[model samples]
Target chain A: MSTFSKTRPPLLETTRPTADQTVLRVTDLTTGFRRGATTTEVVRGVSFDLRAGRTLVLLGESGCGKSVTARSLMRLTPERAVIGGSVQLGDEELLTLPLADVVRRRGKRIALVPQDPAGALSPLRKIGSQVSEVLRVHGIVGTRQERTGRTLELLDRVGIPDPQRVAGSYAHELSGGMRQRVAIAIAVACDPEVLIADEPTTALDVTVQAQILELFQDLQARLGMATLLVTHDVGVAERMADEIAVMYAGRIVESGLAETVLSAPRHPYTAALLRALPVPGVRRGELQPIPGQPSAPSERPAGCPFRTRCDFQHDACSEYEPPLFVTDVATHAACDLMRPSQQAVG
Target chain B: MAAPEFLLEGRGLTVTYGNGVRAVSDVDLTVRHGEIVGLVGESGCGKSSLANTVLRMVKPQSGTLSFNGKDLLAMHGDELKAVRRSLQVVPQDPSTSLNPRLTIAQSVEFNLKVHGWGRRERRARVMEMLDRVGIPASYSTRYPHQLSGGQLQRVAIARALVTDPSLVVCDEAVSALDKSVQAQILNLLAQLQRDLDVAFLFVSHDLTVVEHVSDRVLVMYLGRIVEEGPATEILTAPRHPYTQALLASIPTRGQQRAAIHGEPPSPVNPPSGCGFRTRCPYAVDACAGYDNTPHAVGPDHAARCVRLDDLALTAPQAWRNS
Candidate 1:
């Protein structure tokens, strides 16, 4: 009855090279912007991998460069910005690829679902035309009839109640949650090997946020696309991430399996952040706020960026930048206290 | 009559906007001295309208409002101005609330100046309040753009409290800041509330934040209070199905996956009886034209439901752990 029921199943064979494998590998990724005379490094020396059907969330607060890092991975940074890193997608390196090649791969190989769907969507165009445009540009489905049918099917798959009506409606005619659903439908139209969702539900309502997250999980399982989610909400990260990489002032302070790092984080920043978050049972006025503001990218201190605010700071924290130390539990933390030579951070 | 126990009280307040939208419909609200009452709901739930009513910003079409044990709606001219000084509000966005041209000290001092404080006294008070909010004396001269979101928020709070208001209404004051920064602002607000003995009408869409800061919680759905009670009681053992659904929708708290679906009914033309009946999971035919009246479930705890007795046997707890 559906457009894809007979010919295709999520375009799986076209995108997936090998099922359930590491499709994208990134290392030492750095992004910097030149303002006036100085170059401020926003994302410095970050490394991680994205596997098929797994989500690796780059979790951090606003100025921590999580968004800039996501932009760097997608090669969506401005022309003035400086980007450096090894980004491996199968046999090719994404960063070193030609401009045309990267453009070709953007929607077909690695698609991006931006934060504000209202802003991301074309206000002038109808919802169906936009999705069909992506399909037409990629040359995936031929003919006007097939494209129209496929757009409706995609919208339906994203959980829009009345796909037929929604296809004819403009972006403004839909709600925040519906606009996001349409954005997802467009992103997954070509069945990219990697999908980068940057704050997909941040602008939406809390209830709507939960529904969108469930859709992301559902689509990932069905399509088996490697997902890289960027969010500041710890709860969203906990809900979606299989592996979590906590970023701080341009660098990843912690990385590991979500279950291990979230439960018992080795980094002081991560521990303080978790405690500071307002969970359900934390009684009134019990939040332990980390003192002082996070350092800007340009104004990072001599050694550790978080030393000025960290409660467990010692002599080593100011003298030498701590490397990511893998604990016995396999969780990695970039802290002097996590070093074998140092005692545990109290 | 005995002296009113509550500092601010509104009886049967109904606020209807010009666009034929009834924002606040027959809402009875109250806040005690030094107590934090959280007004929570999604967009268009009229939580802001209730706060505006308390601030006397919008005149209710039909309601008797009292503040500081005096009639607020009846007061006019200078008397209203003098009384309304004590009803200060911290706006949602700190960046816009503050003047870009003005320095941090100038911004906080501007409020004191309006209340007709002397120049020397205003300068002294601004420094003291800035210190209390964790903004250094040196950074006080910096412009709004020079300060971070958290610092700007502290400046905003200092500005709001500079007049020494009795009831400071924080309208999503921390919603703009990052999580860590939000924590800092929340802690500062709570500490200041106790130190100054000022009641707060904390308004937010975030249930976690509302539960964290509020002593009592008011759940608004389509311009009506669906549930109201002590924070722990309302969030942990919510009697209203709407409150339970909100609790269950929080990913960190209930179900490990959010289940609540569908958009809220339009405020202009809400569902006949229960506004929440459209999205409520346990909605029934009896819910139509059900009056949506409040029934007291405990001390200061009430819920609007026709089947409270039926739900008492089945859904008693908030199901946060579930």
Candidate 2:
């Protein structure tokens, strides 16, 4: 039996919190793209909740549908992409909302911190005005002068020195850490309830990366805003996440509190990912590489998506795709290894 | 016992760009025979310049670089050409390092042919290098685009080793790959070092990766060596303030991280005394005019900081008095 099954039934309360307390909620969300006559699924039945004052890390390698899931929450997926299922913000269903309404709520209710800070900010515009544009558009500030004043304050809050000078400088004038802090300033300008940071530190140096992460942690604690951190590095997840979701082939193979999932991962895919990481103390030449690349969205398998690379794959793994079965309401894994001996208890 | 013989020793090395921009300064480093020495610093710190100078890729304005008994800067023509073959460089991007049109085998064999090896001998040496790097002979026909990033890097490494160079400089050679691929390449490099006995001059900004691959570590700043010592001792208990900060700033796997507050100072006009004084949290008035010279802090532990004498004081007090 899984660890959660030993706990009492009342502790297994699966009643998800209401919308305001729960910053973002997704259910049976499926997203895909159509090529001529065929539809290729990129993200299938992905569900998770980002509540206020907690970090929900989407951990996966490239093409594991982590980004797709994040983009879907904002309805930022392209027109050619087909999206289904319900995404709720508090009580309102976002998936059914009009495009115009979605755009209105984009920066006001939720803000996105994209992967590349250097590419995200316009090169021609001064750093201060770019931040002011968001406040001006949302009518958050009355006058242009007031917007500039607020921009300086936000810059200082994100750890930039000489905010007035930084405000006048262009994107190229700033370093990588300074640029990322500017991006965070832009995201947190409107004081949104949810912030989605996608691989924000992937391109930075190690020292700068640690500073950026520490900044995020400090901001999260101060603002008490829910955060969705998307990264492929297990180390990044370990440092930032309160809860973790391990995605494989466009599905969450495991999800639980970060400490539990990280220290005691149950799924084979989760175990493989943890083993693949090159930790500092570990010897250099003794890497345990997970053989074979993750299957692409266009060429996924018929049964279990990870069967081809899974070390413990059985015949049943190919014959049937296991449903996401919960050992308790808090933790779940979609694998035959976790399949109970008896028919799943209702 | 006498000191282990260093295959390459660089003392008082200095490189200055035009307009009074010093790219490197009185840097001292050594890579011993059958050992790997890692030189780590962030972008613009001149680690790459140091490695390139060893290969004579960039001529230094001053300093002495000696491989065995010969001074590198003093060599020219045939002597320089012979030295270039003895030291090979594996650049950051393998795709750009290798000629896209050439096949894997032809790429490795080119160096042998340039050194005046006969056609038959070149082919045999190319095959041997290919096998050593774990690439099959059949892959000899494949172009750069056909191979994965990992495979491309292997081909780059094999090509560098084809001439049987005694010293190899890998500048972020495996930084571009995924974690698993990075592990595999590191393991391969370590195995190759053991089997081939070729000394490595490794340069990267990632401390964890550097610590894993290096026997000795050298921490560089703007354009100078701030600290140098055995890898484990330096990484575990760094004597220099900059080195300590660098190690403290790294976010290890599954460990909580402490904040690194400020950015590195611009290198164009580095501060007087020590180049790292501006960012060294333990800076004082004396640090502004202190002599910039390497001093012994412990056995093999050396740093170019003024506060090395007062280790018993509180952090803030040390900073005030440094």
Candidate 3:
């Protein structure tokens, strides 16, 4: 065990770089789907900044608009959907880019590591060719020889043991973990400035999931690319995120550094979510699951969306939606309980 | 002294699929009355096959399965159907398992009606079971689509328990749910187990969940039981390398653990001797030649490792502290 641990490269850098450079900035991004007269807003004014060479994890349960927010950044919404807000990647505003320009910039400057590795790859194509397709489309390499050489290099970089043999095999022939490694290889093939991974490891076993996460950390350090990861698992967020943003009912309720938000959550929903997880040591029946389900976009409450299920709800919490209150230098929470007057009332 | 009563028992259980792939090898498992036995393993490790075999959903190639001292494998026709009333299963996905067209009440009373119960008794028992699972009696009139995932799972639990089975098999029952909803369903299962004294064969890939709910835990690897002991002991002081690696793989709050390398070997062509030798960091030269057998490490604690006596294995710090 000691030999393996010593021989293996360090999974992640102990000290995060203090560069503090913002790579992707999203401001008041709202996405809504229109059907006839009713327009249901799925992502309501979500905002965050992703630092270069760091990860910002959007944590939420299903239907909380975390996935929609990620998709909106890439302009991947449906034709009928209405998108409002500015997504600035470096100096370019992605939302205002033309269709041809966005398509060019997609694989060239930004890439997506999607969930469902099994379905993400084309079943008809071999793994090596699929990875090479990215290189060809992005014009990362000029010659076919260069593409093949780069594909093997990328596969090897993602920690595939037998890259030569694996590249010849189809997606179905590889295991789930190996297929995910192939997907990551393709996503990083172009060395995109920003990588958006949506539940990349959710389908894998625990052991394989850890490996994929470690691979992401190593690649982020080596490539210095910003990563925006969206996952429903708190443990995944705890392990991967430099910054954490808690989303509920189509809005971010808390945003801050991972250690701050996880250790001392300000919002009731965030605290409840942490408490609800069945961590090892917590006895059975001691877990306090939040009482109610998240409200649907169409049935969102008038004030705070989480007021229906919050344990620390007050009369003022139902009167108006609270804007994010800056709790510390870098932490903020959108909850009435953050106010001194509310604390006094209690 | 007389042995403690076991609600479900299996000896030398072996199951092989049509492709000549042995999904489950000769294994022995027992569940006492009102106890929860958790089966944990990676996907394709044969945990599901063992669960399905015990439920009698799949016929075993060889085994002795007895539920309540009656031979389960020998029963057929009406006798099998009669015995099925005492064995129930709660599947992973509630939405797919339930008939979308049927109302919640109808789905809950399905087994009761199938067993030739009177309409009044079925209705009464459905209402009672629904209330027991924390669902309001009125929601029974609504279809499954009208309820949330957590509510639908409660309905599934209600349907399973309505027949009052002595043993229930939960195959990844809460894996589909959100964290909050998963906790609710787990708590509901624990509460129901205490209130009804029903034995549960809880099968899941999530180790933390299995630890919380199970009295005894069984770890499977490549169609064999690698470890079995009390949940606390197996989780905290794992004897097998596979179990230690699994316990360490979990991404906890503050601990850093080396991820286990390589995927599990294929069940179609598993390695000789120790099934876990391919990925285990502690595999030795002797591991390739030793036959698979459980070595007793302590009281009620056993592991399928040849070097169990020599190795000093401890779980990760997070698990030990937890």
Candidate 4:
């Protein structure tokens, strides 16, 4: 644990934004889809703030609404889907904006680096043309020559060697890591104020994934853009996040500084997730799996959604929905274990 | 030293696709009884090709494969079928691997019926196997779609192990699972190994998972085994440059990650001399002309690197310290 601190001193000390400097502030954001007569809520009031030059990672398991939450910010949910709550980029209200305005804002002010780079990119187009499309649509550059030059520059910035050859290659011709680098190059073409990456490296191999993550850090440092990284890997979250938000069945279960939250998680679900990882130094067979599967939104239990799998559940855990209880100055957790009355039992 | 008993052995295995791409080349592997040998590499590094060739699912161009003291490459017809009962496989995706039209009970029993088990014995054996994998008997009648990914994977394991196989080839068995479910499956595999004494050829890209379950580990690069040794020694003190880079790339909970440069070279026409020389940080001019062969690093550990003699290698953390 100390090794992490030794290698990279807290960049937040110099890059942390002061008060009232939040780049993207999401409040009580909820999204739902209606199929026939049934309406199911996929994202249930997930809220977090992304400050300039800082990363706030939404960490959770599959079907935990982390992806949906990222999608909700960009209004990328399916057609006819019901969306609620406020998504404010600075003074602009993104949720209530007109479709035309939202379309204009996308890829210019709020860009997205989606998961599955192979699927995110068009196989028919060359990597150069695809990246130049963002610049053309956003009007970031003046002429076609400028577009090509900027596209090559962005590719090189993302750590792709021999940018000219890569720019001429199609998506299928490039390797997985090269494709992902092209995706990031497009996302940062216009230098968006906020970059929402949804499991950007999930499909890559470990070594390639490490390279991509380091590229993200480098881009963030140079461009000073607020990054909202969505991933199901706790190890990734620990390495990349300045602030951490643990999401469960659509709702954030805990939020705090990465060091505080990862070192001593207040929520039981977060603790269980950290425990589930097969850490390098730990002996085999010592891993404790969280019992029961994560329930879908349609099958969410009453009160606390995690009570069904929680080992520390009591009568109060299922009796009432627990709110985020402040455990420290900057740490808050949505678990009954933090309640004064239930504290004794825990 | 006494000769060790090998449940499965491959000598100079080579596989080439129809497109003239050599997927696996000149590789030797052995899994002793009651041992778990993990095969790890990046995607498209011939891990799956090698595992499938051993399972007889894919034909090798040049190799001698033997299982349970029988020459697998020479077996024909009934002999091959008889040996297949002792060699089972659990594939990566449980959803696509299982028959969707069949119920869980029917799926598990299908294997036994193919092996010529009677009706009454097959039903009892299916029930017992399902229970052992932690799936309840009541859900045996449900379809594959009705079960979660974890439960479906358990059913897959139950089907593979119902015959009491002497060796099982788990190809990315837990890679698609969630972290918690992955832990449960790994623990279950370990428990089954202890009880059944079945040797497993575990293929995965996850080093952490491989280090946790494997007694010995083999690191692959560009369709070649770059390092082979005991899991503890290989992970803690790797001798090959590629193995060191692979270990350093793993994102531990609170450790700083080290990035390896560039993508792997194309297997169709890999770089001459060392396959990893193009991406190797310590490559020298001589590396381009040196022969790749096993260099002993320990009593039971060996690496295929020409620089093992003159160059000193250290773990990723050591670089960080210096």
Candidate 5:
């Protein structure tokens, strides 16, 4: 009965986007980086779609290619990164866009609210000035005074107390929760169609974490923007996501409605994730952890990425990669055990 | 009933830095022999500061600390050294606390050697402690960097326990490990407490891990304990507004979500009356004028809110749902 694990509802309901609207469409996405003489394929054959106003969570452990997938979508891929994929933001082919165009697209078409807010916000600059700088870079506001006024408004919108005073305070002056609020305000300043939050509240305390998650839920409704929340915490995924895509290595092991996936997960990895939740009332030390560490990009196994750790893995699972199979129109799982005929697809 | 045999006690302890930065207020805590007391709070809640104070790394500005009837604050010279040898710490970050150059066994045995134990005795004790922490003794010759986060933490605990310290302070100890690893370490700590009768000062922001291990919980804010009680009672029916908000904010399995708005107030220039009143939803004008002093609200339950009249001491709706 620790005070830290109590659950709270998402502050709002999911926005009902028109059924035909697809905010993001990613297909056959592959990315790799060179280490000395060898090129390591970090993310291989990744594909998923995010709908307007819906939360599509990329769930996985550290280095499971979750962050790489989100980064590729924004074309924020590093110079060391070599990417091949089809990433379409609405009608625009994001992967094929020019470098200059991609720069323009950042914070305008799509924005990222990074993992560690304390690190993401510049330590040297005042929070308000840092937010205004985003507006200035995007050329959204013409004058400095206008941008300052807008920054104060943004601070107020994010629930910062004494907006004027906070505007003049440096990042060090704010707490972790306040810094996260500043980061959120910056991400939404351009009114982007998509907001990608990478472990936004992982480092925060429970109460502070709840407040930040509520902020995202509130913004998603008011702005009608598609949100991609990336986290490893299943409890967080349950409270925040409209749709969940459980990632393993570099592939989506399971993708389905949040309720369906959480309540009755099909993929082994998804099931393990749900079972691993340290639910109170369940005897302690009974948490069934997903067995092994995620595979390294250079050390990609021959067949199904999860076979080494999967309890139900069979001989065939080590010979060929399992294809993502549709269980329903809206639910898909890439697992040999979940869908035995998965190999027959494509 | 006889009072529980306490291994360590901090009575009216206070630690203050220059510029009037009071890190630990008049705090009282007891770690019963063979029991774990969870000092749970967010960053800057003085959990670390209090731990350092107990270790005598940072001298307290006021109050007394004792271990097994020995006055920790008054002990000096060789007496202090003996006290230090008996009360050890398993710090949160293994990467920083451990020496890279020394092998795990050497690191552990160094403590024994400092206490003037013979080389053979050191080796035997090192192996025994390693086995106790669930680390294979064969891996002892490997350097600290060769170990995983979980393994390194075990080594850290083994090193602390080698000298047979009665009280061990774990500052955010298991927070660095992965979820499964956290469970294993917590289980290991609990098992060690049961078998060895070691008292633990468990400091962490992770409530799940804390509840799983701690017998009693202390909720700290701005260097003061807002509430202290049995884990189940505090978790189920938190009487303080700050405690309620903290409980409501976490996303636990089976619990309903109660989203708190805004972040906690700045500790440096904390608000008048209750430090939590600025963001508290139930705050009235009376709360604005309330003194920043602790008041008893229930048996073993205390809060610093001025709105006890208007304060709806209700169980967090989130927990009820769970």
Candidate 6:
């Protein structure tokens, strides 16, 4: 009998947060874009700690400021976006760093794999030149010969077939999966301490997405680097993250261990989201949809940003914003109903 | 159960594009009167091309397609137009489907207008469909840009059903919406299917979504139907190796995951014999030959695999919990 989908050993293992060294710490990050004379805040007071070899996933749907928060960490948002936050990378304050200093540290210290590999890559340059450019900028290799050899090595490591042929071809010539592999090769050329991938697998097909996600997992296991992944896919978060921060309306409504947050989400928004997704073996009529569209930053109310669609509504929710209340061990939820004082009543 | 009456039947459908890409090859499918038939496949597998064939949007190079026992390929002019009225489509993106210049009411009314409904009757029917889909009458005046994705999808559904079509083809209808919002649209489609008793050709790349909504499912791989059976049996105990691999590759809430390497091969130069032979882990020497025989595993379940009888594959524990 074929044992293809049987309960054999897992093909890819989910790495626990084994390393204790805190690599990157972000505190109260707020990002806003200039609209006329006023600034429209997109990311509001987002904070997280990324330990070495751990994956911290910023999870949210569209317009939830998850992407904006990821961009704010690297100062990669558009020119008009005003970022106010303290990003600490191994005793270095990245938010206050000079432009040139940040540029020097981009590939050498932290790397980003964007959502769209096509947009991230240069259409005119060959794939080899792009990988070599990263290595050269970071001063990884001295000679041109070493750079070419290392370029091909990086491509091959990322699971690209026929590195020689792929290196000579332009970005537009490869498939979406191949372009993404080239993008991964470029991002990891310098072996950065911290990696930030924003929706990296959202653009590819399911089979290719599995391969790319496995590449990320394998690289993180081998190199022992910290990853800050931002995505809207629950399946990716379930498979990849050590810790997950559920973002809603520019703030983290829930943060906890990935297993806890996904299986027993405390926040109303978090629970609602899990209920909405279609799962195999789920009995019909169990899909309870969240009532309304996610509110835009401009339309968000003063109190709980998620109260409009939340199933459990309290009168105090309209008066003040809820703080992050500890709901369980290693889990926090920003819900008034989950407060310690109201535990018995609730 | 007694034999079900077929609403649409397609046999030996094959489509070769201008660039000689074999998109849909020798696929046979059927949809009952009010049943939801889900067509599942990944990108480059020609699921969309096969969907287009069923939609009558493309004339296959060699095939016979009939709807309501009427030969679809032989129709011309007024006959095709009359048949076209019954074959409605809901595309992947609602933002692109609805006209930005037209109001929501007019967008839905356009279908009725094309069917030659009177002015007064068109307005009344448009309002009726809008309310049935749970869109407020106040929203009918707003333009497409003003509505949300879920609302716009409801409008698209309303537009499709306003013609009282026999079959509605929804191609990736909920793939664009956020997961939370995607639920609302799926529930809406199921509700409409029950209320209207209309046959729906639900095409999506996600098996999780299809598992609950579909009465029967057709698993396509590399321009062929690898498995066709009841949704429960196909999703839980798929006999085809390709279907098993497809299910395993999806990272789920379960603890297990099987990494299937490589993307789908290019359709322009498909491999010989079994289209999935290149990726099948259990591929045998016999898989290299074209026997083109479907082995039946159950009363109404079948898979086109040479090693179907030798496979005891079950879906992941998460998929078999219930």
Which candidate has the highest lDDT of all? 3
Report fnat, model 4. Answer: 0.58
DockQ-based CAPRI category assigned to the predicted complex of candidate 2: acceptable
Candidate 5 chain B: worst-modelled 10 consecutive residues by lDDT: B313-322
Query: How would you encode candidate 2's per-residue C-alpha lDDT over A54-126 as one tens digit per residue?
Result: 9999998877899999988999999888999898887778899998888888886789988899999999999
lDDT of 3 at A206: 93
TM-score for all models, in order of appearance? 0.95, 0.88, 0.95, 0.94, 0.89, 0.95
Score residue A253 of candidate 6 by CA lDDT.
93
Runs of candidate 2 with Cα error greater than 4 angstroms are: A1-20, A33-40, A78-80, A298-302, A325-330, A342-346, B1-4, B252-257, B312-322
Per-candidate local distance difference test: 0.87, 0.81, 0.88, 0.87, 0.79, 0.86
Tens digit of per-residue lDDT, candidate 3, span B170-203: 9999999999899999999999999999999999
Tens digit per residue, CA lDDT, model 5, B1-322: 5543677888888888876777887888778786788888888878789889888898998888888877888889889888877788999999888999999999999988888889888888999999998888789899988787888999999989889888899999988876756766877888898889888889998766676677777888878787787766667667777777776666643344454566656556667766666677787777768665667766656666676556666554533122
Error of 5 at B32 (Å): 0.3
Cα TM-score of candidate 3: 0.95
Give the count of colliding residue pairs in each prediction: 0, 1, 0, 0, 6, 0
The CAPRI category of model 5 is acceptable
How do the candidates rank by DockQ, highest first? 3, 1, 6, 4, 2, 5
* Residues A168-213 of candidate 3: C-alpha lDDT, one tens digit per residue: 9999999999999999999988777789999999999999998898
Interface RMSD of each: 3.2, 7.2, 2.4, 4.3, 3.7, 2.7
DockQ top scorer: 3
Model 3 bad stretches (over 4 Å): A1-19, A328-330, A340-346, B1-4, B254-257, B319-322
Encode model 6's per-residue lDDT on A273-315: one tens digit a residue: 8878877766446789999897777788879999889888879
Residue B282, candidate 5: alpha-carbon lDDT: 82
Worst 10-residue lDDT window, candidate 3 chain A = A1-10
Greater lDDT among 3 and 5 belongs to: 3
**TM-score, B chain alone, candidates in order:** 0.94, 0.92, 0.96, 0.95, 0.90, 0.95
Decide which is better by DockQ, 1 or 2.
1
| lDDT by residue (tens digit), candidate 5, A173-273 | 78888888899989988777788998888888788788778778778777778889999887688788888888888888888888787777778777776
TM-score of chain B of 4: 0.95
Question: What would the per-residue lDDT of candidate 1 be over residues B37-91, giving only the tens digit for each residue?
Answer: 9999987889988888888888899989898789999999899888767989999
